[model samples]
Target: MTTADLHTLTGAYALHALPEDERREFERHLGDCEACTQEVRELSATAARLGLAVAETPPRELRERVLREITTVRQEPPAHGRRGRTVTTGRTGRWSGYALAACIAAAAAFGGVAVWQNQVAQDARQEANQATRQNEQLAQVLSAPDAKTTSGELTGGARGTVVVSQDRNQAVFLASGMERPPSGKVYQLWFNDEGTMRSAGLMNPAASDDAVLLDGPVDRATGMGITVEPAGGSAEPTSDPVALMDFPTA
Candidate 1:
């Protein structure tokens, strides 16, 4: 499914309002789309805070219906499983709102506590999956051949560790232990490949020295450098490299 399709169904899925056909379809979409699943879970949490909400009277009987339906569909949180490994996505859902409304109106509803709880567990799982993916990505980028562990320093009144992965596919420069520019000055990263320079990003003197792993689209060249440039940085280096790191050929 397209990203737009997943976004369209996110609200329905999180609120547990999707019809049977839609639920099955979305599940298939989620299996392949990590980004969508994460988006849905975060939205679910926001919705949950309003579950026991008074901003609006729920449509009535939504809580019970959602519980009964999700009961058979969702698995309960494993009490014996790793602690905090799982979490309830959120308490508020499409059916949940409907159920809550009904409950408030003194209407009788199917009293299924077990099913209602399962939805909570599913939410927890969604959040766990997101965190796991980020951790894995961090490890992956760090393993790149160009990954460098430098004794952080600054030069020409500029400071930062230059990291250009072995393949020149990823890079990151974190700065610390340096003085700020004399107003209107900034630090920039540029990737020089085949005599062409592309601006990577700007530097903030306050940036920490942590091993900040940056996202991709880095220089395809074997060489990398940091320069003192404009606030937003330029495509080409206006000055010499205060710091330089290179990626080796595989």
Candidate 2:
């Protein structure tokens, strides 16, 4: 096969998915080819790095597992000829068993790192959520009606002004600017009726004036919110919401 074909086969070889004939051909070519060997080595190292990205705890008995596998791998005996006598004169080493142990140790170290990163990420997410809810509370306070219209903004024109009726049973989310979601998803408006958030309707996430207009004689609505949901609005939100406006009521 050409050099280009060999390069393309590197990934598949690391995954052990190459066909038997192709595998044999590549092995034959590799026996005398330095470039192919380098390519395969680089790809194997890259695969090893990716494997490190997923943190997993190795079994406590991993050494035993390695030993078992090594035992099962049959070594080819040297043919009884002049070459057999020469083989006995060659270097005798048992480092291969030790090399397998090193590979397992490397895998375990990577698994540990991945798990640590995941934990750090999860904590950061929780902190962000707490900050968001606090900001929502502040917005609710700032938007409360007092026989006069009130307004506020999030940084970078990212926040929208909220207007609530004096009686507070009805409101409208007049959003001037917002990011658009991809196809097969929509921004759904909702009302927190007596602590239960209820769907009002979905809006055009891309339109300049396609407001997430909400009108409800909705009972005990303490929270007004908007969520980017699936193509069809969900019965309940499963993802983090985009906008959650809090309204003041008597």
Candidate 3:
């Protein structure tokens, strides 16, 4: 093969689409060509990224169609040059129709990777923004002039404190020394207003230094309590509370 033909086979080499003999010849050429080596490395990394991006299984029909095309596709005879050796015309001719199909597939795969990367970045940004807003709201409630702070102990050697802001209708609960809940179970928070009890939020029992900023109707709450419940939490306290702290009223 000519130097130009070997250079053109870089993509095929990267994709493992080159014929055995041509692949060996290309490897020899790659040793002396820094540009081809770099190109092959870049193409390989792109292929890896594309593979990671494609998480879903391809449709059954796609495999069936490709197999059908392989059976029907015809191969033309290779052209002879002055030295009686075969000379491929272009990228399409250098490899078979399957190689052209692969090129198209690679283009589509890269496009998918771009879209997947954008979606991941967008999700991360949204999560960061949400965390920022939550922190700000928590800070506002904790720093409020009318906020009330109280502390107490629980049943399982756990200790908890709550700071409530009647002005902002929010509260912050901090707890420690709670053991991790059993599998399929979770700790759930509750707000009791007069005799009515309502779910405040779920808790992570594994947290040694847990801090949760509770929202919704905090101004009317008479007390806060936590209980063990199912994994997703429950509408009401399923069991006796591990901890309970009454809000001071004057």
The clash number for model 2 is 0
Q: Highest TM-score: give the candidate number.
A: 3
**Ranking of all candidate structures by their lDDT, best first:** 3, 1, 2
- Report the CA-based lDDT of candidate 3 relative to the real structure: 0.61
lDDT of 2 by residue, 1-250 (tens): 5533443344334333345465555554455555555555555445334322333445859834753343233222222222313211101112234554664578687776566446645543443344334333323423444412334453236556555554444454545445545555666778877667888755443332332235355457766677778655678876776766666443
lDDT by residue (5-27, candidate 1, tens digit) is 34345644554445446555665
lDDT tens string, model 3, 19-125?
Answer: 44665566666556656655655554453333223244469898457544442332232222214444333433344456556655886877775664466455434
TM-score of each: 0.37, 0.36, 0.55
The top-ranked prediction according to lDDT is 3
Per-residue lDDT, model 3, residue 60, is 88
Give the winner by TM-score: 2 or 3.
Answer: 3
Error of 2 at 15 (Å): 54
Per-residue lDDT value at 91 in model 2: 13
Each prediction's whole-model lDDT (CA) = 0.49, 0.48, 0.61
